[model samples]
Target: MDMRTPLGRVRGLGSTNDGVKHWWMQRLTGMALIPLTLWFVYSAVQMSEASHAEFTVWVGTQGNPVLLILLIICMFHHGQLGLQVVVEDYIPSESTKMTLLIAIKFAAIVFGTSAVFAVLRLTVGSS
Candidate 1:
């Protein structure tokens, strides 16, 4: 007696092409973040002992705008990827996983936008 159904035997078995995209995106974002995060941390540490006026002046520089934007982008992208992996690994129900993923994406968008806006307001308003 054959153990497999005719349909199962004939159907091609493999991924639907999602795995490679997800992996590549994760690694790409991670690589982009390394330099951005290092610069952020270094700037933060440099500002650790700065007075208010000094700190504001430092951030008012042109380089700071690009750094701040990079930080915001990297932060949200990393957050989204991390949350996705968590949801995929732990959430068993399809409905729940989908809901959580959507929620995470929106939350990341809202928070990231707000953060960038706040940074811009501070930097632009100061000068």
Candidate 2:
């Protein structure tokens, strides 16, 4: 038996089919960020008083560059997913929603790439 309410039937709204995947990705990235953020805070506090060269040297240390890149990727992706949900939930206009989603994705890519490149450059230069 068809169980959709009259309003649901009229609007023709239904599952997007990818909501579970989206939810899983968001949760996984959030879980990954927990330890990453803790490490970042601890490192920041440890190096709070270090000189510029010392900071660069730390960034170049074994596994530090990789962790930093992972941090950048996860942070930007998490933020993009969050903003996408807000836009989709609050914005009523389809065109505006699509535009904002594109912008969010673009900004995430640009900023994330820039962060990763900066870390790589520092790592290379420190050697």
Candidate 3:
């Protein structure tokens, strides 16, 4: 039973387009997160008893900043993708959905940028 209207057919939404791209991205981020998260957990455990200065020095080490930045980006982006899916599935009102989605994206961008900036500052500032 086709539930779409003539306009929907013209619109070419749902799985007809865009969905595959979103699905791919979501999966890719998830996969990326696996190793990144494991690395983070291992690093944290390795640094469990370290002092703040030691942690700061560790963050400033070569490659650590880049890895931390990548972690921040992937984590935030993956979270935003999941939130978007939930909003799309649960939210019924179009206007409300769009607003929430926009807000979520904006928040993610803001927080991601802030985190990256903090990492860069800490890693570079003390150098």
Candidate 4:
């Protein structure tokens, strides 16, 4: 029951069935960023003249830490997804593409974790 075309057979190209999930996640994260980004900008402006202790206290306040963590997660995840699409589309070498994708994911996790940890420390230490 071979249905693949000659060219497809030659190239061994086939669907991995993962594109839809990736696409949906990219769109969802992008949509989520809009409000989160606005909130972050508004908060930044509001806290522009805040002292260090005041800023820490603000972070420790109700909902602020949670919002900050969500912002970090969505920001890093969205960036990683966009970068993966770009890398997959443009990069011709499989090895290079795989290496880059791995690096991107790893960096995103490390940086995102550090950002969240910093926020948690601020919230906890301030309390």
Residue 112 shift from truth in candidate 3, angstroms: 0.7
Per-residue lDDT over 1-127 for candidate 2, one digit per residue giving the tens place of the 0 to 100 score? 9998888776634322357777888999999999999999999998999999999989988899999999999999999988989988899898998899899999999999999999988977555
Rank the models by TM-score, top first: 3, 2, 4, 1
Listing every candidate in turn, what is its Cα RMSD in Å to the true structure after a full C-alpha superposition? 5.3, 4.6, 4.4, 3.7
Residues 30-53, candidate 4, lDDT per residue (tens digit)? 999999999999999989999998
Query: Roughly what TM-score does model 2 have, to 2 decimal places?
Result: 0.82
RMSD of 4: 3.7
lDDT of 3 by residue, 73-125 (tens): 99999999899989988998989989999999999999999999999889775
The reply for model 4, stretches above 4 Å from the true place, is 1-17, 125-127
> How many pairs in model 1 have backbone atoms within 3 A of each other, for residues 3 or more apart or on separate chains, i.e. clashes?
0
Judge candidate 2 at residue 115 and give its lDDT.
95
lDDT of 4 at 42: 95
Give each model a TM-score. Answer: 0.75, 0.82, 0.82, 0.81
Error of 2 at 46 (Å): 2.4
Q: What lDDT does the true structure give each of the candidates?
A: 0.82, 0.89, 0.88, 0.89
